[model samples]
Target: MESKIKHLEMVENIIERMAKNCFTLKGWGITLIAGIFALSAKSTEQKYVLVAYIPILVFWFLDSYYLQIERKYKILYKNISAKSESEIDFDMDTNNIIITESVAKKLCYFRCLFSVTEWLFYCPTLVAITILIRILNVF
Candidate 1:
């Protein structure tokens, strides 16, 4: 029972650490993207919109990913927490509650989602801008 408690506490710590890392990554990514778009844009209307959209998309995807991770962690935590309270002796050696392989797989999928969505907005906007410049140059 004591072992189960310790194990759950450790899992909670790991989840918290992961959440922090995600937050930092999201912050830097949003800031850099917004800054680049703003610096390159000719006007506030263009720059502000693009800058605003970048963070929104980033946060939306990050939130989705975090929520998925949170749900899984919650489920695992609940199970382990309940076990700790039960009459049955939980052998920590055998019942260590590690984040399952499936959780890692889901996390990987979320990462891929972030990558694709981020590029979807950034790459297309860049290409469009390049085409516009070329057209203007021809005139």
Candidate 2:
């Protein structure tokens, strides 16, 4: 029983780390975009605005990857919670777990990319970039 608890705690720690990574990625994405925006404004170069897309897209993919991993761990946590003590082998690798078809679809890369939380941050950033590009071109 104690071992099982410890195993669950380990899995929980991983989930927490993944969530933290996603948060950190969001912060970095915003900071980089803001910096790029400043550069574009100061230089009056649309190129900087174009460069901003690299970080935004990269961070978006990374954030989605972390979210996907976090979700897998959540599923693993649920599976572990339902298992017998003997079944709790303290295995933290989520890839070993057999996910169902529907659940697997939800866990895919593109699905994670378009997930509500991901889209909420990245899509707006994209729109903002587009707006910036237009403003630069007009002025």
Candidate 1: where is the Cα deviation over 4 Å? 41-59, 84-139
Per-residue lDDT tens digits for candidate 1, residues 1-139, read: 6777776887687678656756665566557755655564655444343444555456556655664565556556666776635543433331344566775565464554555544464456556545644553523
**Residue lDDT tens for model 2, 9-128:** 999999999999999999999899899888777884557678888999999999999999999999999889888998888888888877889999999989999999999999999999
> How does candidate 1 score on lDDT?
0.56
lDDT of 2: 0.89
Best candidate, TM-score: 2
Give the best candidate by lDDT.
2
**CA-RMSD of model 2:** 1.6
lDDT, candidate 1, at 97: 41
- Scanning candidate 2 in windows of ten residues, the lowest lDDT window is 40-49
